[model samples]
Target: MRMFWGAAALVMVAGCQAAKPADPAVEKAWVRLPAVQGNPGAAFLTIRAGNKPLTLLSVSAPFATRTELHESMAADHGSSSGAGGHMMTMAPVKQIDVPAGETVKLAPGGKHVMLYDVAPGVQPGAKVPLTLVFADGSRMETQAITLAAGDAAPE
Candidate 1:
């Protein structure tokens, strides 16, 4: 009947529709240009999770040939001989967990993404691309505003 055909058409149309993309889980993403060229730069951001936890597996930026996750920890003394007082140690980390309904900050002197051999084009005032890969294999594409040394926080 006509009603059956109409229902079938509606079901077919709904099936053809694409699923809505996932919600954005990143905010306040920005990159800090390295003080010296050829040195590693740093990227900071805040990540939020929805009802389920999300694991940030890795981050990638075109400006840097190699990108990795790292953490800065304060220890009693630095390995360097000249380090008299407390020194900060940085090491690579595998992943960062963003609990449900929680926010994790990737800021200075904490967990952050290290961009190695950053390209010269990624200078101050430049907007670069950053991709965050989660544990579920879903990738979130985002852009980061570059900041120079002594530059104020990005708005």
Candidate 2:
């Protein structure tokens, strides 16, 4: 009887150690890019996960050699105009918080991913598939369509 109890305890510990982490559930995602002409760069949509905290490991797209996370900022102090004033700039964000029943959006002048050096001749109406990996070894895929240059984002 003692031997049986000891064996069972060891098995339970082993099982716990071998258990795999669960994947986070993605709620919604989107992206933004100029339509008329493809630029050297592009911005991606924010992601919102349902009821779980997950770390974003990396992002990839076939259209570009490398995809980097970036943020855009509007200079508030006339920095662009050569005033040398403090610019209201937005920098790249490392992580995002996804609260339960709420969504975290990566919008213009905010937290977003930057797609650099796109494939030659990428045009509007093209769909780009992006794969996002999480820290728990789970992945999510999203497709973003190209928008026309000067086109306003949908409200």
Candidate 3:
């Protein structure tokens, strides 16, 4: 009976232990070159959550004075207006949630990191260092390739 009780205790202890979460992954990170100083630039990437859900708290880049998460959406213009076409606007977001086992894409005309007061050194073909801060107080450092201002989204 003593041996059986010891075995049961070991099994219970193992069952109570939770599995460790996997680290998040960042891929295809790229930054758009700004037209001029003081103009905001944009960064796009694909983020994949690990075994658990992840929240992207903020983003920082050495090339920009300030960075914030932003979402671009079509503006609601009254139907009667003519010749203006459709307008798009971007708004800042506090945090972005990446679901577990799913990939969240930050692409043009969607969700992206807005870089304000861009430094002069940020240009096409330049490699920019970026840091991604998570809600869990963890940070991921990565680099993004800079593309021309008029360049389209990378394939």
Candidate 4:
């Protein structure tokens, strides 16, 4: 009888341990809206990683003539005392890393997607399909709703 009770307790403890939930990581990602028909447009997305680092490989959109990952950097002030800052353009982002247990934010004056020569016929209030590729060979597709033209840079 003593052995039987001990075995039962062990089995109950094992069951409780197995009921733990999975880590909520890299499952929820949000991409901000992209600019349209205003010279150059930008796309912003949010990435979450928990206990595992993630890489953003590439992005594709239907309405853009060309899409590329890009980042904006403030130009070096002539004497580090200039009031108006200049922007120093750099190459597109080929790979991005998202640290574990944090959210990577893509915003204006930071990391963003640059769309050159947006395709015609893409109108406001329309949603464009965006496919994001990951380093693990997994892809996630989401619809990025369009905003009115000349909305300016994204946050």
Best by lDDT: 3
lDDT of 1 by residue, 1-155 (tens): 99999999998887766343344488889999888898889999989887678899999898899999999998775557655766788999999998877789899889999999998876698888899999989888878889996798765
- The regions of model 4 sitting more than 4 angstroms off are 1-38, 78-83, 152-155
Candidate 1 colliding pairs:
none
Can you tell me which runs of candidate 3 are displaced by over 4 Å? 1-23, 78-84
Query: Residue 135 in candidate 3 has what lDDT?
Result: 97
Q: Higher TM-score: candidate 1 or 3?
A: 3
Off by over 4 Å in 2: 1-39, 73-88
Instruction: Give the alpha carbon lDDT tens digit for every residue of 40-66 in model 3.
Output: 889999898988888999998977889
User: Clashing pairs in model 4?
Assistant: 32-44
Predicted candidate 2, C-alpha RMSD? 9.4
RMSD of every prediction: 8.2, 9.4, 6.3, 5.7
Candidate number that wins on lDDT, 1 or 3: 3
Worst 10 contiguous positions by lDDT, candidate 1: 15-24
Candidate 3: lDDT of 151? 81
